[model samples]
Target: MKGNVNSPLHSDYLNNKMKSVQRRHSELKHATPHKLRHTRATLAKQAGTSIEAISEALTHSDTITTKTYVNASNVIPMAVGEIAYRNLKK
Candidate 1:
């Protein structure tokens, strides 16, 4: 199965594979592929990447769609705040 990119897994195959994997790992109950994508986006946001960058990386059709991934703790607002504070002190 490893290093077999030429044999791309189909949707049905992936679903069946996930079923088998989930049975082996009971803790993974209710997990789905979409959840994995959301997790990836959230982690990227937490890592300080801008929403626009994330949007592009995710191939989002609109920026507003990507804004769903934005969080207050993400790096963008913090960086803006820092710059504002520095200017105020100057």
Candidate 2:
């Protein structure tokens, strides 16, 4: 069935749909929509996208909310390492 943004499928429905796709493909694990969102944010940060841009794309009402999505587990150390390597080259 066609669904709009406001008429979005329920989380359970989405999860079940993902599970069905995984089963069909013999894939053991499928990332949930939320995890996918986090991964997008993390990758965007790593790719040098600004926090403000990521926050806007994610439609976060507050930048702090976006910051929470940009976790140390995802982006911080990699950025630091890149900077360290850049400095080493100089």
Report the number of the highest-lDDT candidate.
2
Residues 1-90, model 1: lDDT tens digits: 778855655778777877888999988767666566566677667655677888887779887987775544543434656656756897
lDDT of each: 0.69, 0.78
Task: Provide the lDDT at 19 for model 2.
Answer: 84
Candidate 2 lDDT tens digits, 1-90: 575664556899989988888888875666788977887988878766788999998889877888888764656545766756766898
lDDT of 1: 0.69
- RMSD per model, one decimal: 8.7, 7.0
Q: List the residue pairs that clash in candidate 1.
A: none
lDDT of 2: 0.78
Model 2: residues with Cα > 4 Å off, grouped in runs: 1-13, 24-30, 76-90
**Which clashing pairs does model 2 show?**
none
Clashes of each: 0, 0
So what's the TM-score on candidate 2? 0.60
**Model 1 error, position 60 (Å):** 0.6
